[model samples]
Target chain A: MIKNQFYVISLLVILSMILVACSGGDAGGTSESSGGSESEAVTLKFFHKWPEPEHMEFYEFAVQEYEKNHPNVTIEMEAVADEPYKDKIRVLMAANEVPDVYFSWAGEFSWKFARAGQALDITDAVMNTDWKDQVILSAVEPYKLDGKIYGVPMRINAKFMVYNKAMFEEYGISEPATWDEFLTACSTLKENGVVPLAFGDEFPWAASHYVGDFNAKLVGGDVRSADYLLTAPAEKLFTDPGYVEGLARFQTLVTAGCFNEGPNGISHSSARSSFIAGKAGMIYIELEEFVTVADGMGQDAFGFFQFPSGSGDEGDQKLLTGAPDGFMISASTEHPEEAMDFLKFITGPEMGKEYVKRLGIPSAAVGAVNDETALPIVVKGVESINTASGMALWLDTDINIKIVEVYLPGMQAILNGTKTPEELMQEVHDAAVQAQSELSQ
Target chain B: MKRKFLNQLTPYYFLLPSLILMSVFIYLPVVENFYYSLFRWSAIDTTLNYIGFENYTRIFTDDLVGLSLFNNTLYAVISVIFQVFIALVLAAMLEAHLVRPFFGTLFRNILFLPSVLAISVVGVTWQLIYRPDTGLINQVLRAVGLDTLTRTWLGEEGTAIYSIIAVSQWQWVGYCMILFIVAIQAIPEELFESARIDGANAVQQFFRITVPLVRETTLVMTTITVIGAFKVFDIIWVMTAGGPNHASEVLGNYLYRVAFRNDEMGYAAALATLLFVITFLLTFIQLWLGRTGKEN
Candidate 1:
């Protein structure tokens, strides 16, 4: 009896231990799966469309630095190409798998994502922060929708003419101050066998960008007001007298044979290359490209200038077409607090200044930015944004993206002479109205 | 009775997996896509309202849609006329008595190399070859002192579509060449020998013996090419992005833009439905042609 009882006790103890071991394993698995204490270490997935390794390395370095300072948080960065990144983000948004933090252009389409509640609300954090007062009002305001901040603005890019200084000097032509002078400059450049302006319409967005910047001179209006002014019923901005005049000016350039052969086929990189190589006289580039273009052309070749204003009847040059890059937090992020903390770290004065210094682009931060390669004229272009009475966001970025994807292609057709400008404008207005109704519905 | 039961069940058992796959991949999506076509939808729209036929009506009236369809048809017709006809002629030439002994195999393989490369690579390679400034074609033209003939091949609206088609033909003509070669080779040796014995020349034999033998291959190639031409997205998307103002726009790329970019899922689905109908009708016509020819 004693032996049998001892055997039974031994068997029971072994079985109990096995049960405990299995349950322990299950608990560990469950913990890991449920984002429990051990798995609670914050991981923020950050996505951007810029895939340059050097730029990404800086981002990676920042993430590591941020993590060293904040032990509980980590950031995973992914840089995807342009079209693919947009599609990936859209799919992720639909699937509720968006990254913790992602790059965004501050505009209507981007705002749609924020409005749909897919993005984390950072209004309180951004507004109440001491640094809020330091950020330029123009840059800071666009990221806020309906009085709620959705993203932190990174940089303010001013639209301007970026010329090859080497090419200009070689041709012995000074930078022009007025549209007429600009036209004459283009003619002079063309006469010298240099392509005047290297533009590509093959990518429909390029034409829209140029058109958007041209419209800035006419509207000279606030972006929000411009949006309401253009998209509101019975107010077709594409057909506005100002828009027509801009179109005519644009056409004069095209008709003068100012642009390179197959301008439509020339890509951004190639266009930049042409200007850099002294193959083209001019290209309209955003201010952010100042350092990048200099780096690409090795500082000796490239220069910047503001787009020459027209002498024709128009309001004082109140508005500059602009886009502010921003960062957003994903609503579905596993670590919202950590993501917000990362945003705070990057948007701070030190990082912003360093980024601006590295980029030669102006920052939206209230902090002083040191651009070591300071082309005074370029800095002047950047400073003009702060001095402008108002700013208009790029039309494609400001309006519903439906308008960009649909109507912009039509604009390309008008520019290509495949469709009449009137027809194109009419179709675009219809599309804009249709898009508004669709959005409202 | 047991043997009979096993025999009857054997066929179904063999077909069961494939049937399941078909239901999952093909039929299920067909049903779902059709249902999705009836509703207003978007990537993250929590609700999709049923708006019957509204999307379809919009697609029919859309000018861009019309342009896309016209371009797709144009591509198919041009590719068929040149790609198929030239492939047939080349196959006959290679299989002729003068070249057939050795050069036939060598030349066919040499011509078939382009079809082996990835479509995107082919598109990009041709894009460079047609580049306005630094491309090989223009360089050759300039070197030959024909600078006036040098123009932007893929950029101009006048030549973009044709240039694209030429690139596609360059890539796929090899595939058609192979198909035609096989068809020509399959003509019974007895028929050709008999024709030759009757004092028929090589060309006559080809016309009389090879052409009739290759009708089936022609039908098959036409069907495949037509389907492929309709579904072409990668070449155009990678090359021109249907641009210089939608000059090379095809139904496939246009459908993708409407659905993904514009977030008009319902309208895109409607467009897809029309595409499906067109493809189905053409396939039916091919089948009818194949059947009637066989019957006659």
Candidate 2:
């Protein structure tokens, strides 16, 4: 009798363990969705790229606020760094499995997902919102396709030549307006034991900024948009003399000792840290990075200037190099209403103010930033965006990802002096021609 | 008759799970890779253009492939030499009476520690050590006033590939040593004793006895290490990203960049297939050489 009782007890214990495991696995099911009183307990995935230590609190706050507002919805959040996120998003889309809401770059990046039937069409939902006009329409224009909305604008940025005010003052160098003056400043800075520019090319896109800036100055904006957008035929591909001239001028900067050693091996974050440490005289920074940088380098230390045209046509000086980064919902989301509502709440003016205040993101929502609470550098950033004649989309953003693969490493080749201007441009032109042929096929 | 039949089928039941997993994860992907390599596959859509054999033809014409193959071959040769020959020397040192048994175990564990580390950690640590401006190597060179010797270790085209190769050597040489130590320990005590009794010196005993006896282990270690050197990705990816204008582009990271960065999945698949064939052939050759030598 005793042996039989022991056997029965052991069997009961194993059954209990399996029962617990099954129950734990079923928590994500819609058990709480009877009679449509409070809708199904849906777990909405929120994925994004800002996984830095400081940005964690901002994301947690946003998710917690959304969950509190919608008790029936549970927000499952994930974040990755920028480069990994770029690769991960492609793999996710290729597999036909996407998060409910994810951060995406506008233009060809979002269009790839949209073309793949992975992006959600939020045209009607966006029209229903009251804050539609508050978003800078031009900022969100890149994400629009066929008169349909695919993303909500989360940030606006314009590139600037960010310099340490104290370093420039110590060197007695004002902002250089011409190429000669820029070289003079670089030489002076080097003489004083400071790196002239903290150039980092690890992302390679970061290196392409100079290429874009130089190309903007040399070839007119129309020519740039035509070739860089990869719309031109093989005969009219990136063979423009101005394109080669722009690259040669970039080589001029490298030869002039303007950049620190080993630019291609460094990362943008490390370069930024070096700039903040006053090891470098200047770095090219985006508007969104101003506040964090100012906080690190002290508010009175850093200053920014417009990208110098370097004795080129004055007409191209006003063109801003930037892109609209925004939040887009995927087609796989069951809770479209809840997701849109949450995005509206985040991008709305009230949350926009807090977003700008806390994270220092360059908010696209009107009244998100002001002269009072904003850093002085941010005030200048806002003014730069407001007064810009026209925005020139970043080449990596405007062009297809295929061409970016060529352009980025080509820039690296140019910087490293491994490939000449002619060689690099020929490679880029060939890549563009190949891509055009493929798309036509 | 029923009992005998059931007994024969019992071992297969135990192997079914592993066989199923290997087919699903490894064999299935490889077959799919081969199938996909024949088409012009786009990530945006499933519309594939079946331009048969064009992709393989392109691989032959591609200059990057030539460079990568040369690099991989060089890497395999060096890795085999270091991992097999050098590891035997170190293992013999520990095997002999010069070191205490307790010290031998300690040395073995210490040598194997780097292989236990995550690749990312190892790559980043090496980068810090190799950095031009604020690196330990450059700092030491400067301190000794040999500042001219402190050229960018990974920035210049000539040195970048070799520097990365040196790092791989540092990481795996010790791992191969452990395998050697294990094999050397397993050699019987009587052979060395008998050789010594015959008036053989330490050098003679090592070359005649220990060297020939551990030949099998050398084959195994060389096979593993050579294959490893061919598939190296993380260190190159993290350290230089095949940069300084593709100076350090290895086969593994090159295929990855082509696949994800260029969005040419078909071409990338073809590259992967070529790499697979190359590695497979190299391993087959190693095994063949081992068998021939053993027969001799």
On DockQ, the leading prediction is 2
The C-alpha local distance difference test score for the whole of candidate 2 amounts to 0.79
lDDT of 1: 0.75
Estimated TM-score for each candidate: 0.88, 0.90
Give DockQ per model, in order.
Answer: 0.28, 0.32
DockQ-derived CAPRI band for the predicted complex in model 2 = acceptable
Superposed Cα deviation of residue B294, candidate 2 (Å): 6.7
State how far residue B25 of model 2 sits from its true place (Å).
Answer: 2.5
- Candidate lDDT (C-alpha), each: 0.75, 0.79
Model 2 residue runs over 4 Å out of place are A1-38, A127-129, B1-14, B100-110, B193-202, B286-296
Summarize candidate 2's per-residue lDDT along A58-119 as a digit string, tens digits: 77887888788888878888999987887777676666557888999887788777876778
For residues A161-227, what per-residue lDDT tens digits would candidate 1 score against the true structure?
A: 8787867887788888788888888998999888999776667677777667566776435433554
lDDT of each residue in B87-134, candidate 2, tens digit only:
788888877866746588788778777888887888888877887778
